[model samples]
Target: MTSAPVTQPLPPQVFPPTLREVMLRPRWIALLAFSLVVAGVLAWLGQWQLGRAVDTSPPEPGLTEVVQPLDQVVQPGDYLPEPLVGQRVEVSGTWVASDFIVVSSRFNDDVEGYWVTGQLRVAGAAAPTSIAVAAGWTSSLDAANAAADELERQVSADPTAVVQVTGRLISDEGPSVPPSGADPLTITRMSPPMLLGRWHDTAELNVYRQYIASQTAIGPLDDISSPAPDERSRVNWLNIFYAAEWAIFAGFALYLWYRLARDAWEKEVEDLEDEQAEALAESSTSSSATGAAESRG
Candidate 1:
């Protein structure tokens, strides 16, 4: 007598995890927490930026002489009012070590020399903003390089050290290409974009069009003599520009979270669709095989 064959039970239906379900996963949850922290920090920084964007009351005459906060005097990406070109501003930031570069043909009191410059990553700004700082001046190229090296060493040793630099907010000397047969890396002007090109960790860097001539040099360097500008421009748009940055930053922070979630959801949906297709294909093949076997019987 032939024994009856036992049929195997069908496997339970497989369903893809919903977006909400995927987000609730421990891995995604942890990621969400991290994003939230980042967003919160950005929000706070944007708020800080807002407080300085557009000073409602125009700076009275002689504002140039009064040491104003860097953010109060000019926002990153805004032109320094021509009159505020010689404004004495106090900037708080940490030096970006690898960004210390030597710029040639700087004149101090009409004496031509080299200037050691560095990128000053602004303090308390969530945005990756920086200001070019002419750290010191030297008549000798060796001295300029040495000063730049020393500053880099000091920054690497204590990367987070925040230093306050009081300086004249001078307009950028537009960048110039190296002269014929000159070293390709040679930078002749105090241009932020020029210096930024040589700077490390410059991804998404926001820099001031104007640079700072430090009142005193750092680490074995001579001070940069910055005489006041002959004229100043009228208008106070610094605060207004800064406020706009804050709004953009805040919106970006929230968008980042949504983007991450949406990307994950999209990836999950694709995976689910692929899995469902595979299952259908396998089921169809099995049915075809079973029908063929019965027909042959």
Candidate 2:
């Protein structure tokens, strides 16, 4: 008998690539490079924030305690520097008695009170210059008003008298809005701009952007409770937290690329399985029909 010809074996189909393999494709690699660029920019911004959050050259301890001239420390209309906010400064000026006003909501050692504020026309300036002064603090509103009235009378009696004041120079407590139905004359903050509005002879007046919290009260009120500023820490926890957030964002960028590639690979695998199933079903139907036709013949 003739030998049966050897049946040729069909070649095996190539296995589909894994998710990692899909990620290595040129298109996905380009996307990875773009993500790297974005991450780099975010990291740079985080580093910038870190640099600004801490003070590298803090002033010496008790530097603000040493007395200095008001003009030497800061000029009229100039903003006070942080290191000089509570600086002990000496200034010569004449008090505008009528300009003494009462400011409510003053706090002294956690106690809510009031402040009797005044305008001191700085002495020896070529033009008219003034600085706001929180003369004293009191618990009762009537007491605050009485002190202001007395100070006004004293300044009026000696309008030309030059007085020398030594106190801690401070930045202005910018103006605030009064309560909805509060009195028009009621003020609650030691704001130089607000005091200037109520000051007389303000034509061409040059005013200090900062103010003074006098160590000695002008009348019967108690001294203000302004303590020394605490030394700042070198390490900024907030900046560190922000840096961590940026690092997380960077990691997310890479993870996004991996996820997209994995999704695409999974879809390809599903389609391949569907195509193979359809081919098998068609082949089965063909075989059944051929056998049926032969049997009928």
Candidate 3:
């Protein structure tokens, strides 16, 4: 009797789980949580920007509209206690000509040479105090020097001259990089420390609690003031915009994850069905082979 040929068993095939099945797994839980956190952060930033956009009221309408004497509006301790950030005041004092310092400044798209900063000695205060004043900027070194000279002539012409100065009270400018030069008169920038140091050389006067700027045109001058009308206040909303954009991206990310998961699940289900059909066919084939062998026997 001829022996039946032996058949080799087929290798078991392993199918990968579909995208949907993978998302259903516990491993992807952290990913989902992180996405939610990112979305929340983005939403928070947008709200913060919106708050900034609305929070700013028009510059204290009362202060800007009415021009009060600097001495009356600002006290000796006004700057120290932080009540002078936005207070507009007018000051009457004699400009200390010798104490003029040239500070680097820009105007009208061109780099105007430097600002002529001077100290003003307030007249009627019980104890005399000095106020800082930013006179103006000039194009050339000669012009800067001439401006300082002309200001000195004006101050010396009237020692007790009641020069009227008006401006918003601001904090002292901090120390800046000193200009590299040999000339003492030609400075690149003005800083609080530099001005204070020069005060000893100029006079024995104590610096007052505030600074001033001339509102009217003093001569052939262009602009003679610190803190212009269009100066920007704090509150940048770029971060908020970015946050909104990030939130939108997060939502899209979630959507993408869902789509991938669904596709994976469908693929997994199809694979499982194919496997079941393959198993059933194998079983039927085995049964048929057994019946044939028995019949032959």
Candidate 4:
């Protein structure tokens, strides 16, 4: 007969650990904490970029279009501040014919032109004062001169006439040297000091540091277009893209932690399943041998 079927001991069944259990391990816990720090930093960086994008868009207060009196905005002899630049101010004064001059290299509606500039003796000031004015623009030098000559004649005809001038306030263009042999009436810039040297009654006069680009013209001369203040800021689309990229990075850092943990858990599960399968096969073979021995007995 056949020897009784020898029984073999089966190994203990093993099962894969769950993610919750693995996360409790010191190594995984440390990794998760590190990921948290990295994600936090990335989030902060994205927020900083977002703040930069927001700051680029500035608010508009409509100061450029608001019409105000020049004396109310800035007093003569006082420095024109940044906020007052491009402001529309009205001044009523008589034009000084002797100070009328032409500025070359002026542009009107994107076309090169000349500007006829004059000084206006401010009305009812504490002292005798003047403010430079860009009276009109012309493409031809003769036309510019003709406008100046006509303005001088009109002002001289009625020296007491209070000409109301409305224009945008601008800062001094700073000092510049005219070309040699240039026309004595031609200037390269709107610098007040340069104009002051040629103005009359300086000993008793105070000149405003800034100048006005006039909207009104004499004798059909073209109006000098005063561009409005633009406060709208441009959006940096590239920065916005960077912000989105950073956000994705932050999310990926966390996802990487989960992926690594899940991979380890799945590998352990597969090994446990294989071990259990082998044990089942061994147990089945031993059972069949025992049955055959019993039948033979």
Candidate 5:
């Protein structure tokens, strides 16, 4: 006679759920969504900071050629700020013929040349202020001398006549020593201080620290070209560092979620394993007791 096969009792179910099941739960899903939102906001903020770090303002249009009235921009006897060094300005003044001088070592488009410089006495001045002006450039001393002569002739015709001059404002080049035994009129640099002593009628004359390179020339002289302003962008390393940190934080947020899920899954697996082991031990003890009772009978 065949007896029915005995059935072992099943192990008890674990209380906590696996990682996959926990992730599927509504609470975990909401938490995951919230974490993503927070991470995304942080990442965006980091990117904004990075943009600010690398961003720079564009150079002002026509920085060298934008013509502004001289009186509006600055006053005589004041220092020209670095920002306004190459700006074009217009003023009304009369030429000082005797103050006209010649400067060597001047260059125009890679060609070594000379500059014909002179002072422009401001019109209607009670205190007698003046600004040095480089009237024109030439390759030959004769041409410079001729230009200077022509300018002097015009001033000589009417010294009190107000002449409107347009030119670029520049800082003083500072004084330079003329070569020993050189002509008293021969100058090495375009310095107002050097020219101040040579200028005529200086009992009450106030000289500007800056000078002007005139666009208008006297009789067939080439205009002195103004150089373009320098515009360079500088990078901010701190902002770049912050961007990287934000990206790491975003990844960490996701990792934290994964780690929690994995821990929950491991705990559930351990509980299941322990339940199975206990069930097996109980079944073995029951079998042993039944065999011993049969033996006694």
Candidate 6:
């Protein structure tokens, strides 16, 4: 019987290329792009944080020396200029004790408690404005009441004391409501709605525009002054941290793309080499068979 005709085995076929394969075939290019984008974003966030850190102004000096009447210096519709943000100002007023409201979540140096807010009637102004002087906090309602009573007694006993109150002028924190069963007097802090509920006529006062004028003491008592506006402007670094994390993820995505593309390219090259080798082997065998047939003829 004639020997079966010799034939070379066929090489495995290659799959069609994809868009992703062409785009990220080069690992270095992908890596470079990824690093640049990540660095740019991180640098931007870092600069923003640095700007925030430097944007703040130092606390104004000579607050006591530049004391002026609160009503004269500011009006209901007027904005307190940046220069006066934390300045100590003097107002001659009689305490309107009956209008006191308990603000929740007030704290002293050591204890968490409530703020006893009251209206201060300027010596000559027809309308009284609200002011919040942080009274000492107590853990219980009874203690808060005791503190309120003490403040009331002090105001009543010394109505004509011509109290020159000095404190940092802070914008009113609008009211809020606490969960049911939460006591405003004993709770550490509460929202604006809860305080408004206790008011006979919430509309009487411009609650939205009112501010907390910290009372250092019943008299011009000494304490640390309020913080400067610039100090409050420091950019939150956590935002930068979040940006950095995003950049890292972007870099990782780029890395994954590059790795997959490189692996696919190497596989394609190997397949092509194998096919070429098989084609050459088949051609060589065909030529040798033709030569032997010609000699027989």
Highest-TM-score candidate? 2
True-vs-predicted CA distance for residue 259, candidate 6, Å: 4.1
Q: How far is candidate 1 from the true structure (C-alpha RMSD, Å)?
A: 17.4
The lDDT per prediction is 0.82, 0.85, 0.62, 0.83, 0.79, 0.55
**Model 1 over residues 1-297: C-alpha lDDT tens digits?**
533333333435677677788778787788778877777776777666666554546557776888989998889899987557789999899998888899998898899999999899999887999999888999999989888888889999999999999999988889899988999999887788788777888788788999999998888988988876554343336755766676677677667766787788898888878887787778777767766666666
**Evaluation by TM-score, superior candidate among 3 and 6:** 3
| Residues 42-132 of candidate 6: C-alpha lDDT, one tens digit per residue | 6666556545544366444454346666775567645666556655566656665554555555555655555555555556556644444
TM-score of each: 0.57, 0.83, 0.55, 0.57, 0.56, 0.50
Error of 3 at 172 (Å): 7.4
RMSD values for the candidates in order, in angstroms, are 17.4, 4.0, 7.5, 10.9, 11.7, 7.7
Q: Return the TM-score for candidate 3, rounded to 2 decimals.
A: 0.55
Model 1 weakest 10-residue run by lDDT:
2-11
Q: After superposing candidate 4 on the true structure, give the runs of residues whose Cα lies further than 4 Å from its correct spot.
A: 1-60, 232-297
* Candidate 4: C-alpha lDDT: 0.83
* Per-residue lDDT over 1-297 for candidate 2, one digit per residue giving the tens place of the 0 to 100 score: 434333333334456778888888999999999988988888887788778667788888898888899999998899988778899989989998789899999889999999999899999998999998889999999999999998888888889988888889988888889988999778988889988999988999999998899888777789988887676676778988898788788778888877888889999888877776777677667767766666666
lDDT, residue 282, model 2? 72
Instruction: Report the Cα lDDT for residue 249, model 3.
Output: 71
Candidate 3 lDDT over residue span 1-297, tens digit each: 755644435536667675756886875666677666776676676665556553355445354436667666556645533334545677777766577666665352355566677877777877667777767666666676677778778777776777777666666655565456655544444444467677633355556544555555353344644443443345456655665676677577677667766776787778887887798679668767876786687
lDDT over C-alpha atoms for residue 20 of model 3: 53
Model 5 TM-score? Answer: 0.56
Evaluated at residue 66, the lDDT of candidate 3 is 64
Runs with alpha carbons beyond 4 Å of true place in candidate 1: 1-61, 231-297
